[model samples]
Target: MLQKFQVNLMASKLLWTIFMGLLIPTSYSVFFNTTTLLEWSLFSISSTPIMLTLILDPLGLMFSCSVLMISANVLKFSTIYMKEDKFINRFTVLVLMFVLSMNMLIFLPHLMMLLLGWDGLGIVSFILVIYYQNPKSLAAGMITALTNRIGDVMLLLAIAWTLNQGHWNILHMWMLDENMYQVLTITLAAMTKSAQMPFSSWLPAAMAAPTPVSALVHSSTLVTAGVFLLIRFYPFMSSAWWFTPLLLLTAVSTTLMAGLSATTECDMKKIIALSTLSQLGMMMAAMGMGMVHLAYFHMITHALFKALLFVCAGSFIHSHMHSQDLRWMGNLANQMPATSSCLVMANLALCGFPFMSGFYSKDMIVEASMFYQHNLLMVTLMLVAMGLTSFYSTRFSLCVVWGTNNCNPYIYLEESNPLTSPMLTLASMSVISGAIIMWVAPLKQEMMLIPMYQKLMPLILVLLGASLAWLISATKQKNESMLMQTQINHYASCMMWFLIPLSSQFPMKLPMYLSHNYLKLMDQSWLEALSGQGINSLSVKSSNILMSASKPMPVNYLMMSSMLGLMIMMVMF
Candidate 1:
């Protein structure tokens, strides 16, 4: 019976994946009210859809579709990816938990319930990331875990602040009042979760996990949690006057920085992971600038192509005996034709080539960014970011598909179905998804594409970037930078000096730095530090003193003599 129970876990996990994938479209089909010919009078028709009403907006539907599609592919891929692993049972359970949690997160009506689902998803990702139990992988898992917690803290603070202002119901919350604080808190939280700018390094380190984990968590669902939060709370976000401008600034900077890193990165997974961060930053910028449609479009397109790239990379690794570094790979297009073709198509979508899904939404985001405030520097930064995105994206393609091969003898290519089928499915989606989305939702009427000259800029940047990256690769100029070397050395030193020690010294330095300035900023603006700390300490100390005094006292000879003397005096009286 125990063996049978263990045997059934995998099937149960897979079943849940299928169920989650179908739940959204099924719900939408059943609940979409079409009475009175789609648009009635000022007061539209009434509909009471079960749970679907929680997050039934167009943006919500887009994320629902993304979560479903990615969860399905990850589950199928895991079946083959975890076949030989010892912790398959645990891995399968966490995968199912992650899927169910994310599905619940988008539909949660109450803020607390939404947070519950959000934190659950993060926890499951952390567990899955460390499934290999290697030293470096464990460290990577720790980094992701801590960063996620920091993001959660900001969200919790925002929720508490909202509740303090007597706004427990999000629908009734007003953004025009003193809601700027809440907006800032939520924005900070979202940026951290999405791996924007200074908080971006964690995603690349997360590549230490197995390919399936990276494909599902980093590329598909987990990193997008912040964007989902922003989209879900768009009404409140739109209320903040400064929020859009700030988001635009951060997005442009994050995209450019991540793009630069991606150009020099050699790790196959790391390059895609960084690019995902950059792309997500652009999505946030779009949403912040009131381009929700463009944001949703880009999110859908990014999910398809990023997942395809990760899955195809997995296939390449499985075929080439676990080699993930792009520098040592060359001419794999001829060797793994199916995998190569999928990779090329996926990369094309990422590059925003003509007629691809990425070209539609990505161009929309850049255009929207340009229209908001129209700062020349921000526009230039965004353009440079586009070029960087193209440069690194092309670098990834060149190394994996067209580079020289140093044949490793121990590598054993997996059987075709194990490596090719799932990848082909993802790759096909990468190609077809853009067309389907374009047909389903035309952005021309919604976003108003940028002028012809403006559109030409990104294309020209793309061509220039691809050419520059190819030259860099050909010239053998790729080397680790001083900053990167310092980071690697610092992390190495920590593991060697502190992690090896017997004491419980935590890896809290990074967390401290991120939380410090923000906490200080909050304290200065809202609460006083001395009073809060003093009151808390005083309450604790007084409670301890009262507790000590409440202990029972012993009665001995001294008490008895006093009682006897008192009794004699009373008798005399």
Candidate 2:
């Protein structure tokens, strides 16, 4: 009966989510012509009014709708995925909290309110990441939380800097010159959340969480928080002279780095995660080009397909008894046709196949880059990153779905309703979201009379990448020796160019060394001796001397009695 009640409760929650998901888009369409900015003053800090303001602009509504739709699907999916867990209730609550936090982040324009959502995401995500209670999960959770905390601290710093303007609402303070520090710090904060180059390791490591969490938090909502923040802050950042170049450099580097890493990754989820990193870099690059609308479009479309990909991968992993290594997966198209089909569609979308969701935004981003007089190196890197995205995605599909059947015959692959339902929804969105988003949020590109080569650059690079992937796949079967021969290259690619190890080692090592040397040596030894132990010893010694001095001494008592008598006589006189 209790179990039945739990099931019913979960179903009701899912129904409510679906209702909200459907309601948002409908309401958004009806109110499409209107832009509403609502603010309620929460309190005053000194003389500055800290307000909770919500902006219902087209962008915010679209993103909020996407978050809700995806979240609803994730919740429904989790009901089945987490059915057997004893702590399903706790998990459900956390997922709901995550959803709510993302909603807060999406709608709220105030930095203070945004921080509430931002910190909520960080804390909730940390709990979710470490839900498994293993060492790897714990470590991953620590890294995820700590990395996000850096972003959180930066947000706080931005808030502190914003206080100089005597307002917490970012929209009111549009003058860029006054808030350059705040803008820069906020961008840096967003970079950490989005898992840009230096902070990229945690995204892959965070795969230690449950697949449902991965599908919801890492893939769709949480990771995109940074992009969303940047999209909102685009106006302020536009006038900053140094912001664009710095962002472009970082985004392009991250794009290339993550693409290379994905190609060598063996873990199925991590490959997808790295691909996400690469796509985010692309989005950031687009933003750097001052194409905020285009970046927003890509973000929405990417969320749909990326979530779908993660869900399909989760199903695959669950069927394979939680084995996530792609080497162990092959010919799944024959075994799990429905799931494999979804995987293929998601992959094709990711590769930016023609007319697909990814293509709509990705093609535009490339074209827009060409239209703008960008640095040649930047343009080349962007194009190469696109190709590498296709290459790794194709490589992944070949190994996991279409290659030889590598699993044992005895292993059973289940295709249940709960597993396929959410994926089907996402797959449908992956197919059509590009057109829907483009139609809704139409971005006008300048008609630049560029050469055919310039316009066809993205498609050409994609084909090249596809061909290379095929060649590599074909060669891999014939001669495993090739990879063995190029040991150095293999290691570098596998280690993500040593970025992972360096990020992991340096942050931990330096802090630990400082803690041991400074904390233990100075704080524990010297400070403790002087302030704690030494002070206690001195007090004890002083007490002992005072005790000895006052220990019923006849002279001392007589002197005290005589002084008291003399004082009493003086008072009487």
Candidate 3:
């Protein structure tokens, strides 16, 4: 009966997930109309509205919607994706955990609950990352998990700082604080969680997981956790003088770095992986500039387009016997029409093509940046990032979909096979999802613009980027070099590394470097040394010291005599 209950609980969780996605929206329609009842959950018990908040704020609504939709879709995909895998039960459990955590995260009001959700999300992601449990994949998962844990620590410090300042209940109340320590800690937490700067390396490594895992977790949900955190804590971030500039610096560095790295990547997944980071950096920049809504709006659209891109890439890989190298892939449009079409649509969204969901959010961010102080430089850097974004997105789509027909000699030796109908279905949804996002209201704010041409700047950047990409690719088609490719792949890293020398001038540089590399090594070494000598050393030293200061123990007869003497004395008393 207990075993049955566990089964029931697990099954019910999935049903709850479906309800959270579909039934909640239906419930909203009803609750807004005829229902006088207010259904309270843990979320309600914690949430206190001090500002002009909707019954459900737009950010929460959009995020919850995305959470349900993608999770449901991922569940559908995973039913097949994990079919042959031995760890299916564990996979399902983690997926359920991820869904539950993400839902709670969107609705969480206090910092404590938000941290709980954040850690839960991290655990689920780590489990998903190492699902197969191979050495390389486990290493990848551990690195990401460890890095995220570091971010969590900084976040905890920030929370303590906030509570000390008497911002006890409302974590979102940022401007109320005048503390600089709180500001630095929070900024550090955000940048690390978002995988900005040196922390960005783990994301590409995370592509070692399954394709569905990559699509939903890395591309859409997990990688966006930091960005979402920024959106949630936007009020607090703006209160800090150092916050915006730091955020902007990280954003630009990451954007440029990821773009350059995307160029050199051979694995299809890593290219998309780097691209996700680049796009996320841009979103972070927008958030730092006080465009909270715009940041989340882009995050939503990015989830749609980037997820589709990954699913499509997965289909491409599955079709060709799990080959992830784009260089070996060519002329797939003729063979995998569904996938090609979907790739094209997602690319359009990614390139910020006009009327697409990508265009809407990207424009809002750019507009926010324009309104930002020092608009010219920020906008230019963003525009440059935009160009890189377009170039990489286009390159990713085109190389796999319509590049040269000739397969590499190495690939031909392996004799790759074509994809199946299931793969085609996966690709189909990715394409259709992009179109679906256009109808999502918060992101489709084109009508709210001040003037038609006011929005033209972002469009112009998109055009310039696309045109330059076309020109570069065209030139490359004449003579593509492996050297150029190598440089392009390492472009993001080079930029990040460039910061290391500059960072050397700061007082914290040595500690940061040691913490990043040597501290963990020393920690393990210390543990080993202590463990090896601990028991023997304690036994020898304590026993010798005690013996030197004490007499030998009395025999059993002496103990008996002492007891008799005590009894006699008691009798006398």
Candidate 4:
């Protein structure tokens, strides 16, 4: 139908219209400090009420608006990006469902109702990740699905645990007592969803998906669901003494891992995916420092710029005939000016440059780190991770966008308005959204006291990271001299400290090995001896013995003599 009518682009227009329709009210909700609580009992089960509860608040509405805006642009972008795919309709529907699931997670206050979105993300993400229908996509999809399944189970456990409270609304769970297990599960669920530490492998592997799915999943929908869940549950989960410390460790480790991984990665989409992971760590770090609002603010800002970054990256891939390796992407600046320009701004925003979208929230979090009392080691790691963020972003931009021509000099690179317009829209947001949100959003005013040096720490880290990147880029001679060392470090970094294998193959290998051994022990050994083979052997031996009796008449005679003897004994009695 889309092929016949060419309204392949109309869905995005409709979505954009809805976005414009809701933007005013959502902004009003933010400015006027308005929130609405809506509750309706859907049904009763065994004296328990199943309710559909929605929170029409600044945060929910604002986030919903962001999701719609990004989705609309992504859909428009996909019309051109996926123009040649045979199953474009299927892809469009899947993307719509993905957006719907995220919106559900954003608004629903009820835990049970929230699961509809939470699990929907997991299921739909797996499908999108493997949409290419290849072994690599399948493997990546498996890692993504299994890792998220951990969070899904944790969420379900939280819902079951809270069922005893007679209400499933998470809004009121803050006052309830003895929520230790509940908070722990909620934290675990959030960590896995956001791809922190042990669950970090899937985020990068999910780059096997199409660039559009990566734009959505890495930006706001799938990966952000965890942080969003944590934000919602923060009121109750923060009561635990260990909450901050746990998240602190998770954030630092994940940031370090992703930053290092991005520096060495050659795949364009994976590089951006790793950046998303690093930003998520920053968000988690903010929450860990007891700055929940800062974390949420960072999440929102990150979503905008990250989505923009992915769209720009997607355009690069499309121009190069779907080549995503950074090594093959240089000299694109002159060939594709619009994409190159948007890519530069996206990277700038990602680095949290002054006045960019990321600066408002990210800089606050950086300062708050100094104000908070997380141990010396945690603070150092956090600062180092921030520096690494800038380093990788700079390194990536230097390698892919501004480097010398690495591909065919005469290759055609198309930059249509339909393609460039989405990046332009998101790029504008990436620039101005931070300042607008800072002025409009009514965040709690925290009185922060820090020395001038401490206040400059984040900027200093950014400068330092960029310097290191430039230094390395200029020092290629020394790097080439230590080729073996360079190769070793690159391999390790590309493997993400061996996390990719551990998460993807280790889980599969161990289970398969164990099942193989179990088969050898049970089916091949004991079961053969005690059940089928053993029974067969016994019956065979007995049959042979009967056949060895020489004749059927001899066996019949023996049976008759035994029966006659028993009859004589009965008569004597």
- The TM-scores of all predictions, comma-separated, are 0.77, 0.88, 0.74, 0.90
Cα lDDT listed for each candidate: 0.70, 0.84, 0.67, 0.86
- Worst 10-residue lDDT window for candidate 4 reads 476-485
lDDT winner among the candidates?
4
Question: Could you give the candidate ranking by lDDT, starting with the highest?
Answer: 4, 2, 1, 3
Q: After superposing candidate 1, which stretches have Cα over 4 Å from the reference?
A: 1-53, 164-167, 371-373, 442-450, 475-573
Give the per-residue lDDT digits (tens) of candidate 3, residues 1-573: 432344322443464467576546544543443222222333322343222122345556656666666655555555554556655656666777777787666666566657777889788888888877799899778877877887889878877776554433334364644567766776677676678886776787788888877887865567777777777666766777778878887788788778766755678998888888888888887766766667776787788777777767876676566778887788878776766887887788787887666776786677656654655776688778887777777777667777875564343211112223333443454345445544444343434434556568778777776676666667876323232555543553443444433432344577788886765766665665566475457656855765566566666447545765786588579
Question: What tens digits encode model 1's per-residue C-alpha lDDT throughout 1-573?
Answer: 333466323553555467577555645643552111121122222331112224444445556666666766666776676677766666766776886787677666456557877899778878877877899889878877877788889889887777654534445567657677888888888887887755665677788878877887765578887887787777767877888888878887777767766655667887888788789878876775677767877888888888888888887776666778777777887777887888888888888887777888887677666655677887788788888788777778887788777668566655466456667766777777777776765344354555788767777888887887777767665533222347664443323222222111245556677789778776653465456675566656855665576554455445545765786588579
lDDT of 2 by residue, 1-573 (tens): 444456424643664666576566546653554578888988897989978798877777777777777877777777666677888877877887898898889888899888989999999999999999999999999999988999999999998988888987767766546778887898899999999978888999999999889988766688999998888887777778888888899999999998887877788989888999999999999988888888888998999999999888988888887899888889988899999999999998998899889999999899988887888899899999999998888888888889887877788898888788888999999999899766755465555677898888888888898888888778667312233348787787777778878888766897888778998789878898878597678757855675577867788768666765786588579
Models ranked on TM-score? 4, 2, 1, 3
Quality of model 3 by C-alpha lDDT: 0.67
Clashes of each: 1, 0, 5, 0
Clashes of 3: 5
User: In candidate 1, what residue range of length 10 has the lowest lDDT sum?
Assistant: 34-43
| Candidate 3 regions with alpha-carbon error over 4 angstroms | 1-56, 165-168, 171-178, 371-373, 406-455, 477-573
List, residue by residue over 1-573, the lDDT tens digit for candidate 4: 555654556778877898899888797788889988989999987888999998989988888888899888888899889999977877888888898899999999899999999999999999999999999999889988989999999988988888777789888876446678888899999999999998999898899999999998999889889999889888888888888889988898899888877877778888899999999998998888888888888888899999999998888888788998877778777788888888888888888899999998899888888886767887888788888888878877877777777886766789888798899999999999889888889879578999999988889999999888888777773211121257777777889988878777777897899899999999899999888688679757855775677577876768756765786588579
